[model samples]
Target: MSTVAQPDLAVLSSPWTLGPLHLSNRVVMGSMHTGLEVRDDGGAAMAAFYRERAAGGVACIVTGGIAVSDEARGGPDFAVFGADGADERFRVAVDAVHDEGGTVLAQLFHAGRYALVQGVTDRHGRPQRAVAPSALPWAAARGVVPEELTGDEVRSTIEDFAAAARSARDIGFDGVEIMASEGYLVNQFQSPLTNHREDEWGGTPERRRRFAVEVVRAVRAAVPDLAVTIRLSGADLMPGSTTDDEVDALVRDLLPLGLDGVSVGIGWHESRTPTVQASVPHGAWVSYAERIARVVRTSDHPDVRVIASNRMTDLRDGETVLRDGLVDAVALARPFLADPDIVARSLGGRFDLVNTCIGCNQACLDRSIVGAPVSCLVNPRAARELAFPARPTRRALRVDVVGGGPAGLAAAVDAARRGHTVTLWEADASLGGQFALAAAIPGKEDYAATVRAAVAELADRGATVHLGRRAAVADLAGSDAVLLALGVVPRPLDVPGADLPHVVSYEQALREGVPAGTVAIVGGGGIGVDTAAFLVESPDEVVRAAEFAERWDVDVARDVLGDVPQRLPAADRVTRPGPEVTVLRRAGKIGQGIGITSRWVAVGRLRDAGVHLVAGVRAYLRIEPGTLWILDEAGVERAVPADHVVVCAGQERAPGAEETGPDGLVANLRAAGVPVAVVGGARDASGVDAVRATSEALEAVRRLAP
Candidate 1:
C-alpha cells in the first residue's frame, strides 16, 4: 500500500464497454467447472463462488459449463438448467452480485457425447446420445456416447441453446457467452475430425462450423441488447484436424454474426492431440489468441474486442499480453481461486504481494471431476474465503522463517499479512531453496514464476529477509515462533565406488551442466531422473530412468501426481539412442514409484530413449575409470560403460531437523521466536534430524515474541 497502483490492468480495464456495463478492468473470470451447485434446482455454494469473483473485482463473471437440457447434463448440477425454477433461483444469486456493483453472465452449453452419467449410478443424467463427427469422444471416459443427435435432436438442440439463453436473460444475467470452444458439443461440431456428417451440418468447413454458428446466431437473436460473446478456439492444435488456416476461415465466417466479443482460446486438442494446459507456461498460447484476434479485427468486428483467457495466474503475465494489444482482456481462472481479493490488492498497489495460482490442477480440475467445490492446495481460503480470512490475533507474535521456498514463502506472507513482524533467513543468497531446482526443470518453468511472484509478494508485504545466512539451533534465539522450512538434503548412497569424478548428482546437473555425450546415468529416482532429464533428450534415451523418476509428485491426486502435469504436456523431445542409460531400482517394477498413467508415459519414453533397466539390485562395483558394474537380482555382475553416474535418492533431512520443532504448531512457533511455518519437502520430514531441528528453530523465534 506504499505506492499508488499503475491502474488495475485486469479485466476491469478491458477497454471495451458492453452497454451500461463497463468492466473495471480486462480481467474477466471465465466460466469453469466447480460442482458447487447442490442440485439442478440451482442451489448451494455455486452462487457464492461466482459472486466471489464479482466481489473480487472481476470485470465479468461467467457460469461453469452448465448443462442446458437434461440430455446435455454431464454430471450432477452443472449450472445450466432449463426449468423455470432454476432460472428464478439463479436470479437471486445474480442480485447478490449486482448489489455489489458487479456484472455477470452465464455460458450456455450441451456436453454432446461428452456428457457424463453422474454419481456411482453413472446415470447418463441427461443423454444427448450420438456420435459427434466420428464417434471420437471429447474427454476422458464416462462410457456410452448418447446416440448422435437426430435431425429432430439437432433442431431441438438449437432451440435448447436459445431457450437456455432466454432463460439466462430472464434469470437476470447481464449477458451470455456461447460455449463454442474447449471441445464441447460446439467444438466437436466445428472440428472436422469429430463432425463427419454431410447433411448441412458437416463435411465442409462451413458445414462443420454450422452448429457453432447457429448457437451464436440463436444467442444473439435471443439477447439483442445483452452482451453476447463467443468462446472460440483459434486452432484445434490437433493432428489431422483444424489448422490455423481453418481457424482463419472459421473466424471470417463467424465475425459477421454480431458478437459483442470473443473469448479466444486453444486446444481441447483431443487426448491424442497436443493441447496446452497445466504443464505449459502461462501465456504459452498467446500466439493463438493474437492470430485469431487479428483475423477477427477487420471491419466492425474490431468492436468485437478479443478477450484472451487461460490459466493466466500471474498478473504481470496477463499485463504483458494486454500491453501488446494482442488481447483486450485476460481471463484468470485458477489465480482467482488462490486469491479472491486479488483485484482489491492489485488496485491498492500490492501487485507484488498478490498470492498467485501455482497452476496446480488439483483444486480446479480434480475436485470438480470428483464432485466437490473447486479450491486450491496452497491457498486454503479459495472459494470459501468469505468464511475465512486470516483471523485476528489476540496479541502480537514475532516470527522467523528458516527457509525461503513455496511453503516457507507462503507462511511468511500470511504471518506478515496477519500483523506479525517476521524475519526470514535464507542460507543461500537466493531465497528459494530446492524449490528453485524443481522449477528449473524445462517444462516446469511456470512453478518458478509462482515462486518469483511469491518472493516479490514477501518483500512487498514487509517480511524482513536475511540472505547468505544459515541459522543453526543456537540461532533460534529471542523469537516467538520459528518455521523450519530449511528443506531436505540429498541422501547419498555409501557404496565403495559411488565417489568417482565422472558420477554426478541431479542437484549438480541442475546447478551446473551435463557434458553432452553418451553419458550413462546410474540411479532412477526423481532426482536421478532430473539429472538424466537435464543431460539426456528422452526418458527412453536413459531407458531405465523413467523407472527412477516415475514417482515424482505422486501425492497430488488419485494416488497420482497433480492433474495439471497430465494436461500440461510439453512438446516431445527427440533423443539419440546412444547414452545407454542404466537404472538400479530395489523395487523390481520399473514404473512402481510413479503413477500408473505417468509411469506408462515415462516408461514408454525411457524405452524410446533406449535406457536399460536392472531392477532388484543392491550393489555398485568400481572405484575408477570406465565401467559401472552392477549386482543384479540374479547375483550376476553386469557391467555397463559409464561416463556419468547421478545419485538421486530423494532428499534427506537437513543436517538437523528433529530436535528442532518439538512441542507442536505453537511450541515450534515459540521456538523459532517468530511466526513461521515449513512446507513442501521439509514438511514431510519427521525425525531426530528433521523434527528436532524444527523444534529448536521454532523455539528460537518464540523467544522474540513480546
Candidate 2:
C-alpha cells in the first residue's frame, strides 16, 4: 500500500488563482446554511460566522446559498440578494470577509421542488410553491408535486439568476456561485428523471443542459467583472439521474460560456449513496472530483479549476488529493465549523492541536436541517464564537472539577485558561466517561478524538488532571469553587429477571464482548441503537469489497491490481455472523436523540447487519431461561428467544448529584460558603451530550470566576 505523507503546509498555504481572483491558500470554505442570518437584516449573524473563518486563514469563503428570488426561497431566514434592502444587508458580510483577506462569493440558490414540499414561505409568509422543468414529486418533498415551469417562467428564472449575480457583484462580493447541484431547480432541469418535459428545456441532453448553460451565460453577462462558478453534482446518484457522462458533457458545454470554475457537490437529497456521513471513508468522493478535474484539464477552457467538496475533513486528505492531481482546491464546510483556525494551525504545523471535525452531524448539519443555527459537537463556540472568549478571571482562585469526562475536562481547561488554579478528578483510570464507551462502538471511534482533544486542551491550559482518584464534596472544602461533572450511570431495568446473569448494561456490552448468540437490546434510543451496532458483526472484507465495488461502479479486479486497500482494519470495520441482535423499544421510534442527518445511516447500517428492530413494546413481561416475554402496543404478548438481554433504557443522574436550578448544587455549595458550579450529565438527567456538556462547562467556569 502507498502511504500518503503529512500535508505539505507550504504547498497547501501557497497562493492560488481561481480565474480572476487570487486566494492566499488552496482551502475554500464550502458554503453551508447556518440558519444564523437575521431575517430583518441581510446577514448579521452570517457575517460574524464567515468573518471568524476568514480570520482563521481560509482563502475564500462561500456564503450559504442566498435565495435569488422570493418565489424560489426556502424560508424567511434564507439570505435574499435581490430583495428590498438586500445590498445594504449583504454589504457588511462582504466587507467582513474582505477585511480578513478572504474573498467572499454569494451562492445563488433556488430549492425548487424541495422548497415547496418543505412548505417554505416567501417574504409575505405565504407558502411558496416550487417550480421545476417538469411537475415531478421528489420523495423527500413528500407528496407535493412541483409546478412545471413554463418556457417563460424558465427564462425569467434564468433572469433571476443573472439579477442575483448582479446584486451580489453590486454588494461587493468577489464572485457568485450558481447552485446547480443537489436536486435544486437547475439540477431538476438537468436530470432526466426530474425533467421529463418534451419541450426545448428538456428531452435531449442538450435541451436538459440548456437551463444550466443559460443561467451561467446570463449570470456571467450580468456580472461581467465578477468571477462566476457553478456548483455541480459530479454524479447525482439518483436513479436515472444525470450521469457522469452527462455531467462531463454539461461541463464542457458550460465552460465555454464564461464559467470560471466548478464546485463538485456529490449526490442529491434523495440519493441512496452516502456522501458526507462519518461512516463514509475519508476522501471517498475525491475520485468524482478527479474525474471532473480530468475533464476540465482537457476542456477548451482549462483555466477553470475543480473544487473538491463533500467530506474533505482534514488538510492531510486535502493535500493528498491535491498532490495526486485530483483537485485544484479542497472545500470544507464542517471542518471550519469544528475549527475555524484549522488552516492557520495546519500552516503553523500545529496539527496535533488542531481540533479536527468528527463528522458527527449532530449539532452542525442536523441543526441546520431543522432550521436552527449550525454549531459543532466538538467545538462549542461555533456559530456563537463571540460568546465564548476565555477572558481573565476576576481573581485567581482554586477550583476543583469532579469527573474527568467531557464536561469536567472543558470546565477545568476553561477555568484554568481564565487564570483559575484548576484540578480535574476522575474515578476511572482514564478521563473519558461515557465518551469512552461511545468511542468503543463500531464506526464511532471519532468520539475518542473529542476525548483526546479535551485532554490535550486541559494539559495545554495548565489544568491538573487526576485519574483513578475519586474526589468527594468534602475534598473541595478549601477550593474557591467546585464543578461537579459527575457523569451518568445506566438506568437499571425494573422488570423481573433484570438481574439475570445474561442481562447486562449497555456499557458492559460496549466495553466487553457479549456472548455470541441471540442478544436482545432493550431501549431504541441512541445508546440502544449504538449498542446494537456494536454487538452485530459487519460483513466480511470480501463481502464489503464486493459491495464497495458495486456501489461506486469500480472494477474489483482493477481495484485489487491497483493495490487499493479493500480490507478495513479490525478496529474500524464491522463483522457479520457474529450475533443475532434485536433492538426493542417501548417508544414508537428508534434512535430518538440521533440527529436526522445521521440517524438514517445508523439505521441503514443496522438493517444491513440483519438486526431486527421492534418498536412499541408496551411491557417486558419477564426474562426466563433463554426466552424474553414482551407485550406489544396492541396488548398482544410475544415471546422473543434471547440468550442475553442488554439494557440501554437510558441514563440517570449519578448518586448525590443535584439539579441545575437555583436550589441546585451551586446554591447548596454557596449556602455552605463555598463558591461552586455544576455541569454535564450530573447537572441534568436529560439533554446531555458532548456539545451541551462542553458549552455548559465553559459557561459554568466563566460564571463561577466572573
Candidate 3:
C-alpha cells in the first residue's frame, strides 16, 4: 500500500521512462528457464529462487517461462496458475525485489503444441494433438500437423490471456511480457509454415497477426498502465516464417494494439528456429534492433518503446546499442549472472574488468537444460546466494598459494576475499598456465577470457600476486599456512625417437611455430590432435588453407573428399604463427575431450581436408635426419617422413605421495601436525577434503585462535 523509492542516482541518470515509472538504467534482465525452479514434488523451486535475482540488483527481473494456462507449461517446474486464485508466493517476491529497489515482470506464455501434461489424471495433455494453424513441429521435431483449434477454443485462449494479465497485476507485478519469439506457441501461429488455416487468424499476414494483436489489445485494455511487453523475434530462420518485412508490418499492427513496449531477440537455441553459432559476434542482434527503431520512426505507429537483448554482457555493447538509437533499452541475461554488481560497476564505467559473459552458454543454458540450477561457470557463489551471500570478511592469517592456474586461482581469490592475507605464486611471468594455451586454440578463446577474469578477481581481493616466482616448499615457510596447488608437469615420451632435436611437446610448438614440412604426433589424446590441426593451419594463411585442405583431400583420396574443405575459426579471428603442417600419426581418435559442438566442428574440418591419418603404427627409430621408421600393427616396420615429432601424452601428479606425505613434511604443519585436507583431484582416494581459505582454512585457524 506504501510506495518504495527507487535508487535515486540511477533513476535520475537514465533518460528512459515508462508511464510514471522512471528507469535508472536501460538494462533489463531477460527471462531464462532456471531448472532450479523444480520444487519437491518436482514442481518449481521455492519462492526463494526468484527473490535472489531481484535481491542481486536486477533492474527488472523476469520469470522463467510462466504459462498463461496450465497446459502451456513444459513441466510442472514452470510457474503455473491455479484456477481463479492469486499467487500468494508473489507477495514474498514483490517485497524481496522492492527491498532491493527493483521492479518485476511476469512473462505470460503458452507453450502451445509444445506443452505436455503429466500431472493429475492425465489432464488435457497435448490434446491428442494441438491447436496449431497447420501441422508444424519445432526444433526437436520434424514437421507434423497439430490438432486444429475451433473458434470457441480460440476465444477461450484470448480470455486466458486477459485472466493471466489480471493475475499478474493483482500479484504486484509491474508488468507482463508476451513471449512471441523462439518458436513457441505464439510464434507458431505467427509463422506461415506452422500456420495453415484459412480462418481470420491465418490467411494473410494480417490475419495471422490477429492472434497476437488481439492478445496485446486485450491485455492493454485490461490494465492500461500495466507495462505490456511483447518480445519479437527478428529472424525466426524457418521457411514461411516472418521476415524483416513481415516483422515491420506486424509491428505496425501490434503497436496500435496498446502495447507498452517490444523486446526483441533472435534465433532458437533450444527451439526449432535456425540458430547462429557463438562465432557470431556479441550483440550481433543490435543491427536488427536499429532497423526496428528506424521502421518505428518512419511509421505512423504509437509512441512505444523498444527493448532489445542478446549477447549484451559487455556494457559497451549495451551502451553502444542504446547510444546508436537502436533500441530504447538494453536487456541482458548472462551478464548479470556473471556479475550481479555489473550495473553498479558499469555506472562507474569500469567496464573492462566487469567479469564478462563469453556467450559459452554452458553454465547458463546447458546446465539449465539438464535441470540444474543456473549460475556462472567462473562464479560458484551465484545461484546459491541465499545460502551464501557475498559477505564482507573477518581478517584472518596470512596464507600462501602456489600455481596461479584455474584451480589455484579459484582457491586463492575465494580465500583472499574471505579476509585472508593471500599471496599467489606463479612459476610463469603471467597467470594463465595451460589454460592459456587451451584458450589460444580456435573456439577456445572463451576459456582464455575466463582466465583473465579470474586473475582480475584474485588481484581485486588483495591477493599478492608474484609472477615469475617458481615456488617451492620454502615459499610457505613464513606463512601461517600453505596451500600447495602444484600443477602437473608435461609428460616425457621415452620412446626411441624422442631424443631427436626435431621432437617437441605441443606447448613448445605453440611458442615457436611448427616448422614447415611433415609433422608426426605421438599422442592420441584431446590435446594432441587439436594442436596438430592448429599446426597444420599455421602462419602462411593462404598456403596453409590450401595445403590443409589438400592434405585432407589427399588422405581421404582427393576426389573422395571433393573440392570443399571446412573453414577454420582461426582463419577469421586471428593469424596463426606457423607453416602449412602435414601430420603423421601413431594411432588414436582425434577428438578426445572436446565439447559436443567443438569436437564436431574441429574433426569435420580435418577429415574434410584430406589429412592422412595412419593408425596403430609403432615408432621404431629415428634412422635419418629427415626420416623415421615405424612398425605397423602387423609387425612390419616401414619408413615414414617426419620433419618434426610432437608428443601429446598427458601429465602426472603424485597425489599418492601427497596423501601419505612424509612425516613432518610441509603439509603436516597445520593443526598442531594434522595433515592438510585436499579434495577434488588433489585429494587421495580416502575422501579427505581440500583446505579452503574460508571453511577449511578458517576451521584450521579457529583451532589455533586464542
lDDT tens digits, residue span 1-706, model 1: 0111345554344456754468767777777776554344355355566666677777678777656776666565564464435665677668867877788878887767666653422244343343444566545646655466666777778888988888877778898888878677888887777787878888788888777788788878887878888888766656666667877787777778877788887766244322333333345556667777788776556767787766466665566667656568777777777777777677666665566665545555656755666666555545554344445555767677778755566566666766788888888888666658766554444456556666776676677888898775556666667777767767676766777787766777667665544455555654444444444443221122222224221111111112333342243433335345666566546645442223444444455556666667766666345676777778888776666666665566564345445434335444555454444456564321221332333333333332
Candidates in order: C-alpha RMSD to true structure: 8.6, 3.4, 8.6
Whole-structure CA lDDT of model 2: 0.78
TM-score of 1: 0.76
| lDDT, candidate 2, 1-706, per-residue tens | 0125664655567788887898888999998887665445455666777788999999888888888788677655676765556677679878888899889998999988777435566667777777778887876566778888998999999999998888888789999999999888899889988889988998898899999999999999998898889999888878788877999999999988888889988888877776677766556666777788989999777878899887666687677667765478889998998888889878887666677787888888777766776778777768875566545777899988888877777677667767888888888999788878888776566667768767876677787888897775566778887888888899999989998999999888777768667888889988989888777734233344345546556332221123335555455433334237888899768888887778887788787767888899999999877878999889999988688899998888775456445435554566678877667788786856877887787778777765
Best by lDDT: 2
Worst 10 residues of 2 by lDDT: 555-564
Candidate 2 residue runs with Cα over 4 Å from true position: 1-3, 39-44, 82-85, 116-121, 124-127, 140-143, 389-399, 413-421, 478-481, 538-569, 572-579, 632-637, 659-668, 687-691
Candidate 2 vs 3: which has more lDDT: 2
The per-model lDDT (C-alpha) reads 0.62, 0.78, 0.60
* Tens digits of per-residue lDDT for model 3, 207-261: 8888888888888887777788888887675555677798888888887677767
Which candidate gets the maximum TM-score versus the true structure? 2
Model 3 deviation from native, Cα RMSD in Å: 8.6
| CA displacement after TM-score superposition, residue 28 of candidate 1 (Å) | 2.1
